[model samples]
Target: MTATLQPVLSADAMVRDAAGRAFDDLAADWFRSEATFPDDAARVRKRQALLNAVAALGFADALASPDAREAWVDAASILRAQARSAAPIDMALLLATGDRLASIAGDPSLYECAADAGLPGNAQAVLALALGRCLQICAALEAALDLSLQYVQDRRQFGRPLARFQAIQHSLAIAAEELAASTALTDLALACMVREGCASARLPGLLDAAALVLGHAIDVVYDASHQAHGAIGFTREYPLHRHSLNLLRWRDDLQRLRGGELRCAERLGDAALQAQGVWSAVTALMQPGDRHD
Candidate 1:
């Protein structure tokens, strides 16, 4: 049977602008003081409120629509902005997996339903979480990069700006490259997920792609960010630790979810072997209506 093509959904300038403004305002009003919370309880309360606000903004409903790819993009942007501001909320799992689980709770044995339908729902959820985390990490890295650049330019050693040192510049450059690569991988994964007439068979491969990108990103980006910031990066007073630590924690958390990275790699290898060739396997994973460049 020939698969019907569905138009890819994208947020226009107005939608993007509105989402950006709303999330910025919400983050500023509620999460700006997250780092100053006296205890875990207070932090949890604030995080709940932030999640409520996100739901009210229609994020929960957006994930239910197959064509709501733009909603996913907006969700990622919101998470990224929140992380860059050091919001104490767990944006990655909350929006990515939480919303989907809530939506599917009415069905008892949803896993069986997913299997029968060839949906791979759990993998899709993980893929979404990974993509959201990637965007968040990218934003956090950008903020760290900005801070490091400012510090190196201002702090002088031997009557010269630290930014003039080749070593410092090289480290920052490497961090920048990792950040860019992570962002690009995120974009590619999203494209594959939203391809016109996306197929269930492609879901596992897409999930694997997201997992690999995020796994690599967390390590390289985290190290480079810290190296760029030097000793100050580790201090609690410095904002760099906020992003760096969260990225580290989230990577580990994701690794624990649903048999994690090792399982994802195994599934990818199995699919490739079943297809009989690596290149053919990848090509077969692409959506029927996807454009070739």
Candidate 2:
């Protein structure tokens, strides 16, 4: 039997802005340590704080009670900052959020449904929203390659702006091309999911598109930044390097491990002409043993 979704109370006020405050405080404090984050205790603590804030809102359990609605909305807001700050960390948030919802749904007495279906249902919806938001950022970051090149123009290497050199120019050009591909592919994937309400089976294809684009964008950003800045870019004091650390981790997280591989497999499929054709093929590929069903 299909597990039903419980009615969540309609939430009017959005708590995303408030969560921004939490993220800012935590992020600032972590940066103050002048330490590499993710590995830094301050950064971990900051992420945990955000996780606690969302848990307080009972976002994962939103389907259980109308009372959880406010938390759900608030969790979404906190998620906004997390996505802006770190994408891999978003995976951590998803695991936490998905777990709670699954627990509630599994409790027949509490939610009146099987946990099996509800858990994945909640995960799917949340991930869809996340993928869309992340794609927007992904596109913007790729665009930065062009802007970086412009800034480097008239900039001198030994009294000459590095842009004057053929090698540097060619590197920048390649970075731009790479970014262009990332931007176009992500835009297309997000459109498929957001507008079409693309089927669950098609999620892997969409995420694979995201992974490929995101992974490539990281290399583009890292390479272009160094090519533009030289030795200064590698120093701890440099802002570019700080952000690049997160980019490196995010690329690895999206593509590394068995889980990541499976996620990409969900998307890798035969090429087709239209978006609909692609999704149709992916969906069919994902069908269960009752293939005809």
**Top-scoring candidate (TM-score):** 1
Across 1-293, the per-residue lDDT of candidate 2 in tens digits comes to 33676422222233545676765665566455645556633344344433332332233344224233233334444544454444222334333544554222211111111122253345544444334334434533543454467657846767888888888888778877776676565545444343333343455565676676667667776777676877766664544443565455335434541146445655364433333587666565443322111
In candidate 1, where is summed lDDT lowest over 10 consecutive residues?
Answer: 102-111
| Per-residue lDDT value at 246 in model 1 | 60
Per-residue error for 1 in candidate 1, Å, reads 30
Q: What is the per-residue lDDT of model 1 for residues 1-293, given as tens digits with 9 covering 90 to 100?
A: 33776434343555545666777676566555565666554345335434433332344245635666545666755666566676543434344444554222211122232234443454545445544555566667677677787888987887998889898888778777776776666655656545531233454466566566667766776776677667887775777766776665555434443257888788878878999998887778654443422
Query: How many clashes does the backbone of model 2 have?
Result: 8
Per-candidate alpha-carbon RMSD to the true structure? 9.7, 13.0
Question: How many steric clashes between backbone atoms does each model show?
Answer: 0, 8
Candidate 2, poorest ten consecutive residues by summed lDDT? 105-114
List TM-score per model, in order.
0.66, 0.52
